[model samples]
Each structure stands twice: as C-alpha cells, then as structure tokens.
Target chain A: MGILEVKDVGKRFGGLQALGDVNLSVKENTCHAIIGPNGAGKSTLLNCLVGKLIPDTGSVMFDGQSVLGRSPHEINQMGISRVFQTPEIFGDLTVMENMMIPLFAKRDGSYRLHAIKSVMNERQLREEAEQMLEEVNMLDKRHMHSASMSRGDKRRLEMAMCLIQRPKLLLLDEPTAGMARADTNNTIDLLKEIKEKRDITIAIIEHDMHVVFSLADRITVLAQGTPLVEDAPENIKGHPKVQEAYLGEAH
Target chain B: MFGLDKKDSTLLILVAVLTLLAPFILNPFPSDSGLAQFNAGYPDLMQRFVIFGIFAIGFNILFGLTGYLSFGHAAFLGVGSYSAVWMFKLLSMNILPAIILSVIISGLFALVIGFVSLRRSGIYFSILTLAFAQMSFALAYSVLTPITNGETGLQIALDDPRIFGGAVAADGSIPVTNLFGLEMRSAFDMAVGPWSFTFSAGYYVCAIVMLIAFYLAIRIFRSPFGMMLRAIKSNQTRMNYTGLNPKPYTLAAFVISGMYAGLAGGLMASMDPLAGAERMQWTASGEVVLMTILGGAGTLIGPVLGAGAIKYMENIFSKINDNVLHGWFAFLPDGMEDAVVWILHPFVGKGWHLTLGIIFMLVVIFLPGGLVEGGQRIARAFKGKKAKETSEKATTEPAE
Candidate 1:
C-alpha cells in the first residue's frame, strides 16, 4: 500500500463539481507532483487531503489512517503538514516566534493549554525549530519579522515551519507560484535537498511546469477536476491527452 | 519583544511613588493658591484611576489579542458590581467573597455569551455581545428589578438581617468593608515639612488587587493562549488548518477577560457599597473600549496609559465651567476674554462628551496604535535618522 492514498475521491461545491473520481497514491520517501491548469481542482484536492474540505464521496488515508473526518489539527497530529500557495507565515510574530507555533503544536500534540513559559526557552522545541530554520537557510533571519521578509524568504520560512513537525507526508500547494525565477530555482534546489536528505513523502500541486519537471519523481496532470495522466515526468511531457488538455491550451 | 523595558518600569515606579505621595502632589497647586483647580489625587478621583485602570487592563485581553471589538463589556462590570453588592448585603461587608462570587458569575455569563457570539466572528460577534448586554441592561432595569434593585441600585441596608456581621448603624449604613475584621477605610496619616498625607487601607486593597490583575494580564499576554489569539487575529483560516480550534481558545480568552471585568466591578462596589444599573449601560462599556483603543489596544502598557489619560481628562474637563474659563482668561483683554469664553463656552457640562469625542477622533486618526505607538514613535524619532539603516538589516533577518 502507498504511504498516502486517495481512493476514488469526488467533491462538489453546490452545483459545481470541484473534483471527481480522483485516485492517487504517494509512495514513501518520494516527491510526487500534481500539475494542472487553473480550475483543474488542484487546490481543492490539496484541501481535501489536509482536512480543510471534506470530500462529497471519497476516502483519504495517510499512513493507513483515514483522515476524511478528522479536523485539520488532528490530521496534522497524524503527521501531515501543508504549505499554502501563498506565504501563510504569521506576519506579526517574529520569524523565530512564528516557527515556535508549529514546534509547540508538534511537541504538545496539536492543542496545548499551558499559557505560561517563554516558548523559546523550551530547549527541545527551540533546538528543533532552530535546526529546521538553519536547514532552510533562514537562521540568519530568525529574529526579523516574517512580514518584513521577501516573498521567497517567507515561503522558505513557511516551509521550515511545516518541516519542524517532521511529518510523514508534507503537502505543498504551488510553493513557488509567486516567486521570482531566481527564487523559484532556489526553492526547487531546497526541495530537492530536503527530499534527498529526509525519509518523507511529498505531494505537491504546482502551476509551474519547470518546478514539477525538476523535482517530481512522478507527475500527475489534472484537468477539469480529474486526473488526465499519471506517470513519470518524461512520459507525461509527451502524453497526447495531457498535451491536448493542458499544454496545448497553455501554448 | 513586549517585555517591560526600563522606561516602562520607571514610569510604573513613578506612578506608584506619585500615587503613594498624592496628598502632597495633588494639593501643590490648589485653587486657594490661585493655581490649577485640579487636585487629581483626591480619594474619589484616585479611586477611579485604579478602578478604571483595572477595567481597561481586562478589556485589553479580548480587544488587544483577538481583535474582537466588544461593545458590551460594561454589562459584565455591572453584573460584577451587583453581585458584590449582594455579597455585602447578605454575607458580610468583606470583599473577598464578593470578589470571588463576582468573578465566577461573570465567567459563567461570559461563557454563555462567548459560546454564542464566537460562532460568528468579527462585526457579527461584536453586535451579538452588544445585543446581549442591552438585554442584560433591560432586565436589570425592569424584569430583574427585584434582585437588581431597579433604578435605585443595590445597597447595604441597616434594616436587613446581617448573617455574619451585626446589624448596620441606625443611619441605614453597613460598616465600611473589612479585611479579616480590619476596616478597609482605616487610614494612616504621615506629616513631612509642610504636607500631610493620608493613606487609606481601601486604596491599598485596590492597589494590591490591581497589581495582581496587572501581573496576570502580563502573564496572559505572553502565554501560549495569547499567541493563539494573536494567530487568530493574524489569520483565522490558517489557524484552523493548523489543527487547532479557534473557538475554545477565543472562548477561554473571553471568559478570562470577563472575570477581570467582574473583579474590577466588584472592587468598585466594595469601595462604594453600591451597584447601579448605569454601570452596565452601553456608554460605560464603550468607555473601556475607548480606553483600550486610545492607549494602544494590543500593547500591555497601552491600556493603562489610555485609562489614565481618559480619567485625567474626565477629572479636568468635567470641572470646567464658565467661571473657571473666565479665571483662565482673567488676564486677557476684555474682547479676547469674551472671545475665549465664547470659544470654550459650549464644551462644558454634558458637553464634556464633545471634548472626549474630539480626543478619541484625534487619537484614532493620528495615532492608530494609540498612546503606546505614539510613545514608540517619539522614542524612535529622538534616537536619530541612522536607525533606518538598522531597520533595513532588521527586515532581511528572519525572526524565527
């Protein structure tokens, strides 16, 4: 069985079918990319996997546990973290403080009632968060406000925020959507390094073909809320249906 | 980052020392000396300073952290005052039970309101709190009049049976509040040089409670719950997705803030031995909100400054009349004196609202972060123009 599996998922928003009959599996210790055109339900699918939106009919299993009915925090506790398409770092909190939030959740198991203590003084969590920030090349910026960072740095900080929990599966929604070309290349390299170093599964949704082609071990093309093709990147590049459904339209 | 800096500590110590030596400081420019007419350290006004300081601190919990603008916190205050008064009437004029009962009752009240109001966030939640507070006011005015004492308010009575303490004096007065049989109004008088200072036990009691409340607020401000509330304010959707429910955290904050309000209310009733329905009015609620906003809603010291500034203005503005105005312009030429009176004439009596209104507008417009932000700006300006270089470096650094 795959480490993360989506079995025949179907979702609707009122009369509009956001996703239909989607089946995908992410293997352990591999990067799987989901590439699609706009309105192809890529984001919607990511939402369902992270427990943001419940599928109308489907089963999502992470590490053999059904995540369909769990709250987002509960799913996070089950070791799956998602980086939003936008840089969703807590802007007002210092970069160090923002990272401490997830570390607190990770160490305390999602929800904690302890309202005392300097969170930064928690030796174990602080070390872990600092280590993660260092890994993301953000240690130098740890004292700065997250809001003050460039868009690329914000995304990088957000990524570190997710990784600190050491989730079994990390979901990325267009991680480089708004980044400059140089920043995008840097992010691709960072993801590649992280994938190579960690025994973690990754499922990413991306609009940029370059990022998908560069990092994905296997790529799935989603069109009109359904999977058009799922195969190795090189094979997907030449698929006739994928060409007609996405690239042809893009060109 | 919000840690108490040296300036803050110094200001606090100054305020404390000044409060401790108020009899001298307040009387320095007495009206009889042909100087300022305001004697701010008078017992009644000083009592207001500490009491309202407590109220604004509690208010900062909800408004500052979560950014939920409540318009009905005064209702909680009123409820607490009423409960404290009842404690004095039935139990003893001991403040401990009254304060405890007030806090618990206010917590329960806040729970019900928070449970319902938190279902809808932002402006809707604010309106819901307002509606509930208005309903509470209406009930206190009419439906619950027997218990709340209607417009006359709740007060200690000599005719009532005192279960714990003996009956009140023939003047229909209960004894002044006591702490373990020690009279709260008992005073110590000290004389130095040309000044005599009176320190009342009641002020000490209020001051100690205010300190504890302030400490608890500072704790809550730095707590994990505080971070969660700030997260909610920053981004609710992201918080939900991060696997924590916003409702429970917000509800807890609301309840805590409500208890603080209750404590403040109970303190007020304990000091005066009366609880009026007007305490729960919308305008009263609006005053704390104003105080919190005027000081700097999210900052720890902001609300206290806001409360102090507002209360100081209230003490000064309410006392200004045509005679006082004429006194200021007594040295002016006749036409100028008349012009000054004309200029200041309409802004007295109930017209005190106009002064407050203008101040509120100015604060909100020019100083969005309130007096706290203004202070930071001033400090930043005085530090010199070179700080912008450091700010550039600061922005590049990731704060995590």
Candidate 2:
C-alpha cells in the first residue's frame, strides 16, 4: 500500500463533472507532479486532496486514514500542508513571524486564546522557525515585511511557512506559476534540496515541464477530468496518451 | 514614517502629561461657551471619553483586524445597557452583577449572530450581522418592550427592590453605585493656578478600566490568535487551506468586540442611571465606525484617537448656532460678515453634520487608512529616514 492514495475519486460542479473516476497512489517520501491542460480539472483534484473540496464519489486516504470528510486544519493536523497557487503569506507580518505561525500550530496543535500570554516564544518553536528560515535562505530578510518582498521571495517565504509545519504530506498548487525562468529554476533546486533533506511526501500540480522533470519522481497526466496516465517522469515524457493530451498539444 | 524603533519617549510622556493636566487645561474656556459646553473633562463628558474609547477599541478588534464591518454593533451596546438597568431594577445598583450580566448577555447575542453570519463570508456576512442587529432592535422596540421598556427606555425606579448592596435612601431615589461602600462619584479636587483641578473618583475608575482595556488590546494584537484573525482578513481561503477554520476565530473576535460594546454600555448606565432606546439606533453604531476609521483602523492607538476626535467635534460643533457664528465675526464689516456667515452658517450652525460629512468624505477619499496614515505622512515628511532606508535597501539587494 502507498503512503497516500486516491481511490476512484469523482467530483461534479453543478452540471459539469470536474473530475471523473481518478485513482492514483504516491509512495512514501517521493515527489509527485500532476499536469493537465487548463480545462483538465487539475486544480479540482488538488482541492480534493487538501480538503478544500469534497469529492462527489470515492475516497482520499493519507497514511492509511480516510481524509475525505475532514476539514483542512484537521487534515493538516493529520500531517498534510498546502501551498496555494498565489503566494499567501501574511503580508502585515514579517517573514520570520509568518514562519512562526505554522510552527506554533504544529507544536501546539491549537490556536491559543488571544487573552492568554503567547507560547510562540517557546525555545523549540523559535529555534525550529529560525532553522526553517535559514534553510529557505530567508534568515537575513526575516524581519522585513513578507508583503514587501519580490514575487520569488514571497514564494520562498510561503514554502518556509508550509515546511515549518513538518507535515508528512505537502501539496503545492503550481508553486512556480508566474515566476521568472530563473526563479523557477531556483524553486526546482529548492524542492530538490528539500526532498533530499526532509522526509516529506510532496504532491505538486504544475504546468512547467522543466520544474516537473527536475523534481518529480512520479508524474500523473490528467485530461478531460480523468487521469490519462501515471508513470515515472522518463516514461511520462514519451507516453503516447500524454503526448496527445498535453505534450504534443503544448508544442 | 514613524518607525517602530523610534526612541523618542517624550511624545508619549507629553501626551500622558496632558491627560493628567486636562481638568485645569480644559477649564480656561468660558463655562457657557460652545467648546466648554462639551468639555470632556466634565464628569459626564470625561466618563464618555473613556467609555466610548472602550467601545471603539473593541470595535477595532473586529473591523480593524478581521476587516468585518458590523453595522449593528449598537444593538449589543443597547442590550448591555438594558441588562445593566435590569440588574439595577431587579437586583440592586451594585455594578458588578450588572456589568457581568451585560457582558454575558451581549456575548450570547453576538454568538447567535456570529454563528449564523459566519456561514457566509465577505459582504454577505456583514449583511447577516446587520440583519441580526436590526432584528434585535425591532424586538427590543416592540416585542421585547416588556423587558426593554420600549421607546421610553428602561430605568431604575423607587419601587425597585434593593436585593444587592447599593446606595439606597429611605425616600427610594435610584441609588448611586458603590464599590464595597466607596462611591464611584467620590472626588479629590485641588486648586491649581486659578483653576480647580478635579479628579473625580469616577474618572479614576474609568481611567483604570481604560488602561486595563488598552493593555488587553495590545496583548491580543501581539498574540497568535491575533495573527490568525489578520490572516482571515487578508485571505480566508489561504487560511482555510493551511489547516485553519476561519469561522471560529472570526466568531470569537465578533463576540469579544460585542462584549467591549456591552462594557461601554454598562459604564454609560453606571455613570448616569438611565438606559435609552436611542442608544441602540443605527446612527450610534455608525458613530463608532466613524471613530475607528477617523483615528486609524488597525493601529492600537488609532481607535482611541478616532473616538476622542469625533466626540470632541460633536461637542464643539453642536453648541455653535447662528448667534455664536455672528459673535465670532462681529468686528467685521457688515457685507463681509454676512458673506462669511452665509458660507459657514449651513455647515456650523444647525448643519454641523454637513461639516462632518465633508470631513468623512475627504478622509475616505484621500486618507483611506485614516489619521494613522496622515500622521505617518507628516512624520515621513519631517524625518526623511523612511525614504532613505527604502531606497538604500532597494539598491543594496541583489537581483534574485
């Protein structure tokens, strides 16, 4: 059995079926990428995984547990973290402060009462946030407001935010979308580094073939609300169905 | 522009000093003058300053942090006042039970409102709150009149049984509230350079409460829960996807803010022994919003500034009439005086609201962040440190 599994998941939005019967399994600590055309329901599938949307049919299982009916935070507590398509770091807070949020939640597993004295200054949480910031190469800019950062820096801060939660599974919804080519390459390197250093199972939805090829251990091609194929990246690059559905159409 | 690291303690110290000397400073105006008529240093006015400050501070928590614009907050305040008045009527004038009951009842009202309202986000949520508030107001005005006393408002009467400890007289006039037998109205007055500086016991009580409220606000602003509330404001979807249910946090904020309004209402009743239905009007709700915006919405100090500024203007403006307007321009030639009066009469005399309307429009248009931004711009213009640092940071950073 795989660490995370999707069994015959289907979702409908009004009269439109956003996702057909889709099945996939991700092995432990592997980087998986989902790619599809604009109308292919890739985002819908990602939302289903992160508890943003519930599937109309089938089940999503993480670490042998059903995640279908759980709230996002409950799912997160069960070791899943999501990074949105747009960089969604708290703009008013500093980079370090943003990182501290997930870290605090991870350590305490509760949003503390506003009336209570804060527990964020706990030594372990502070040290962990600092380590995560340094890993993301954002230690120096830690005090700067997250909103004031450039687009690439914002993504990096968000990455730090998600990673600091220390989730068993991390979901990225187009982490490199709208990024410059250089920034995309940096992100690829960052992912590669994270994969080597942390015991995290990552499922990323991306349009960038270069980013997918650089980081993904497994690739899933989606077309018309169904999985066209799931294979290793090398095999996916040459698959006939993937070519017709995505690659050939792209070129 | 005023960097958080600015070490000038003098400004804060000066403001503190001014507050300390307000009684003497405020006494210089002629007692009958328009400005003097609304002098907040007077027992009634001073009480209002602190009480409304509490109301606005609580409001800032919800509107400032969460970006939820609640149009019916006055209902909570009114409910609190009514509850407190009932405590005086049914129990005794002992303020502890009244204040406690006020908070609990207001919070319960807010909980019901928040639970339903939070189901929908954004403008829908705002409308939901407004609906609930209006419903509460309507009920209070009509259906619940038996309890609320309807348009006449709820008041303590001589027939009220003094079950709890309070200042009751043999003749049965409504008793003054006393804390452990010490009257809140007990005063300490000193003569200072041709003026009597009076620091009434009630003023001290209000000040202590205000300080505690301020400290609590500051603490909440710095907390993780505060961070989550802000996150909800900025991006609710993002917060949800990150494993947070924004509903609980927002609801908590709504209830907390409601309690603040309740406390303000309770204090108002305590200061004076009557509760009015008019206090629950939409206009009173709008006044708090105006205060929050005018001061500076998000900043800790902003709401207080907003409340004080608006209240000060209301006092000064409402007192001016055509006669007062003419008195100011009496030395001018007839034609010029008449022209000045013609220009100012509509806005200042009976039309003080016109002046307030224009000011509100100007602030909303030019200073969307309110007086906080205005203060920042002024500070930035004075120091130029803000500009220099940003340009330097820009130039020094390497391209990613």
Candidate 3:
C-alpha cells in the first residue's frame, strides 16, 4: 500500500461540486506532482488531505490510519506537514525563533505547556534550531526578523520550518508560485537535494510545468475536479489528454 | 535568581527597591511646602497605587502576550472583592483566607468565562466577555443580593462570627482587617526637617504583592509559553498548521490574568473592607485597558507605570479647581492668565478624564508602543548626540 491513500473522495461547497470521486495514491519515498489549470480543485484536494476540510464521501488514509475528522495540528502530529501557497512563517519572530517552534512541536507533541522553563536555557533545542538554520544556509540571517526578509528567503525559511519536523509526508501547494527565475531554479535544486538526502514522500501541486518536469517522479494531470491522466513524468509529457485539458487545443 | 537572566534579575531588584522605598521616593516634597499637594505618599493613595499596579500587571499578561483585548476583566475583580468580603464575614478578619479564597473563586469564574468567550475571537470575544461581566454586575446588584449584599454592598456586620479571630474589637466597632493583630490601617509617620513621610502597613503588603506579581509577569514574558502566546498573536493560522493549538494557550493566559485581577480586588477589600457592585462596571474594566495601553501593553514595567501614573493623576488632578489654576497662572498678564485658565479649566477638577483622554490620544498616535517607546526614543536621542560629539572630537584631534 502507498503511504498516503485517497479513495473515491468527493467534496461540494454549496452549489459548486468542487471535487467528485477523486482517487490518488502517493508512494513512500517518491515525489508525486499534481498539475492542473486554474479552478481544477487542487487546493480543495490539498485541504481535504490536511484536515482543513472533510471530504463529503470516502476516506484519506496516511500510513494505514484514517486522517479524516482530525485537526490540522493533529494531522501534523501524525507526521504530515504542509507548505502553503504563500510562506506562513511567524512574521513577528526572528528566524531562529521561528525554526524553534516546529522543533518544539515535534519534540513535545502538539500541546505541552512548558511555561516556567525559559526558551533561552533550552540549549539542546537552540542548537538543533541553529543547525537546521545552517543547513538551510540561513544561519547568518537567523537573528533577523523574518517579515523583513525577501520572498525567496521567506519560502526557504518556511521549508526549513516544515522539514525540521521530519514529517513522513510533505505536502507542497505551489511552493514556488510567484518567484523570479533564479529563485525558482534555486527551489528546484533545493527540492532535489532534499529528495536525495531524506527519506520523505512529497506530494506537490504545481502550475509550473518546469517545476513539474524537473522534480516529479509520477505526474497526475487533473481537470475540472477529475484526474485526466496519471503516468510517469516522461510518459505524461506527450499525453494528448493532458495537452488538451491543460495547454488548450493548440495546433 | 528566580530563573531570571542577569538583566531580568536586575530589573526585578530595581522594581523591588522602588516599591520598598516608595514611601520615601513618593514623598519628595515637604508637607509644609507649596508642592506638598503633589505628594502621593499618603496611606490611602499609596495603597491604591500598588493595588491598581497589580490590576494592570494582570491585565497586561493577557492583552500584551496574546493580543486578546478583554473588556470584562472588572467582573473578575468584583468577584474577588465579594469573595474576600464573604471570607471576612464567615471565616475571619484575617486577610490570608480572604486573599486565597478570592483568587480561587475568580480563577473558576475566569475558566467559565474564558472557555465560553474563547470560542470566538477579536471583537466577538471582547463583546462576549463584556456581556458576561455586565450580566454579573446586574446579578450582583439585583438577584444575587443575598450573597453579594445588593446595592448596600457587602460589609462586615456587628453580629458576624469570626472563626479564627475575635468577632468584634474591644471598642465594639467592626474589627478592622488585620494580619495577626497588625491592623491594615496601621501607619508610621516620620519627620525629617520639614518633610513628613507616612508609611502604612497595608500599603507595604500591597506593594510587596505587586512586586511579586511584576516579577512573575517578567518570567512569563520570557518563558516558552510566552513565546507561544506571541506566536499566536503573530499568526494564529501559522501556529495551528505548525502543530500548536492556540485556544488552550490563550485560555490559560486569560485565566492567569483573571486571577491577577482577582488578587488585586482581594487586596483592595483587605485594605478597605467593602465590596460594591459598581467595581464591576464596564468603565472600571476600560480603566485597566487604558492603563495597559498608556503604560506599554507588552512591556514588563509599562502596566505598573501606567497604573501608577493614572491613579496619581486621578488624585492630584481632581484636586485642582479653577482657584489652583488661577493661582499658578497669576504671574502671567491678567488677560493671558484668564485665557490660560479657560484652556486648562476643562482638564482639571471633575474634568480630569478629559486630560487623560487627550494624553491617551497623544500616546496612541505618537507613541504607538506606549510610554516605554517614548522613554527609549529620548534615551537614544541623548546617546546619539554624545556619540556625534565624541566622533567629531576624535576626527578634529587627528587632523590637528
């Protein structure tokens, strides 16, 4: 069985049938990409998987456990982390402090009240956070306020925050949505490096064909809330159905 | 020393010293001098300063840390006062049981209110808390008369049974609130030359408690939990997705601050054994909010400074009638003096709130970070001037 299994999932928001009978399976230790045009229910599907929304029908199982009816924090505690469309790092906190939060969550469950113990004296956690920052090449900027950082740096910091948890499954909803060419290439290389070094399963939803072709082991093209095609990246490149749905009928 | 770093420890020590020496520091002007009217060392006013300091400190813990602006915290204070008065009547005249019972009861009240109010956030949460407090005020004034003593308020009666201490004093008046035969009204007067300082036992007790509260607040502000609260304030959505629950953390902060307010109320009743429903009015709640924002909401010492400043102004400004204003501006030309008094007339006497409102406006607009930021700006300007002078001297000396 795959690490994350979705079966016959369906969702509706009032009059709109956002998702209808969708099924997806992401294998362990592999990068799976979901590519679709605008308004194809990519975000809705991601929300369903992350417990931000409950599917009207069917189930989402992570590591053979049902992930439905749980909170976002609970799903995160179960070793699933998500990178949002926009970076969601704590803007008011320093980068080092931002990194410490996910580490604290991983080490001490979701809700532990360590009120009396000073965060300053948590030498082990501080060192771990600093080491994570170093790995992201953000050690120098660790003391700077995160909100003042550039967009590329914020995304990098956010990725570090998620990865520090060592989540079993990482969900990326357009990790490099709006970026300069250099930053986009940097993110692609960083994801490649992460894939080479870690035993993680990444399920990314992307609109960028370059990002999809570079990192995806398996590609699924979705259109109008249903999967149009699912195949290996090389196989999906010349698929007629995908071209018709995503690229439009050019030529 | 109490899990505090060097800077924090020093701050705690400074605060302790200031509170311990308040009687001396606040009575700088001599009793016979013209400035004697400005002296804030009197027993009644001094006790109030410390008591309200405790109140503001507690309010800051919630509003400062979590960015949750509660508008009904006075209900907790009122609850605390009623509990303390009940303790005095039923248990004993000893202040210990009264204070303890007040804190516990107010904590429970906070739990119920916080649990319900925390379900909603922002203005809804504020409105919910306000509604709960107003409901409590109405009940205490009407339906809950037997327990709260209604409009007359809860006062120690002559026939009350004292379990630990005597029911009545030798003179047959109601026994004053005391700690092991040390009366809360007891005061010591010291005369040095023309200046006279009055130190009250009650003021010292309240001041020490305020110091402890302030120290505890400093620890909370620096703790991991405090970080979590700040994180919540920064972004609740990010916090939730980061695998941290924001509700329980905010509720805990709310309850802690409520207990602080309750402790202040208990101290107030201990100093003057009376519990009135008017203490729970929405305006009283607004006063603590003003104190926190005016002093510096998130800063450790800001709330206390704000509380002291407001209370001091309340006492001193309310005493200034047109006669006082006229006397101060008498040196000016006759027409100018009258003009000055006309401009200042609406800001003194019963118009002290108008002055407070204008000051609040100025602080909110110019010093968004409150009085703490204002002080920091002044210090930085001085330091900058000194640095410029030293740099110029070094450059000129090298040129010569």
**Native contacts recovered, in order, as a fraction for each?**
0.49, 0.40, 0.72
Give the true-structure RMSD of model 2. 4.7
If the candidates were sorted by their TM-score against the true structure, best first, what order would they fall in?
3, 1, 2
How far residue B190's Cα lies from its native spot in candidate 2, in Å, is 4.7
Could you report the DockQ of all the candidates, in the order they appear? 0.47, 0.41, 0.80
Ranking by DockQ: 3, 1, 2
Predicted candidate 3 versus true structure: per-residue lDDT over B111-184, tens digit per residue: 99999999999999999999999999999999999999899999999998778666788898889998877899
Per-residue lDDT of candidate 3, residues A1-251 (tens digit): 89999999999999998888889999999999999889899999999999899999999999999999999999998999999999998999999889989988888887777778888998999998998888889999999999999999999999999999999999999999999999999999999999999999999999888999999999888888888888999989788888888877334
Looking at candidate 3, what is the lDDT of residue A168? 95
Best by TM-score: 3
Q: Note the chain A TM-score of all models in turn.
A: 0.96, 0.96, 0.98
lDDT of 2 by residue, B201-277 (tens): 67666666676676677667767788878877876665665666777888899999999899888877876667877
Q: Write down the lDDT that model 1 would get.
A: 0.84
Docking level of model 3:
high
lDDT of each: 0.84, 0.81, 0.92
State which candidate, 1 or 3, has the greater DockQ: 3
Which runs in model 2 stand beyond 4 Å of their true positions?
Answer: B1-20, B28-39, B165-172, B185-194, B385-400
Q: What TM-score fits each model?
A: 0.93, 0.91, 0.98
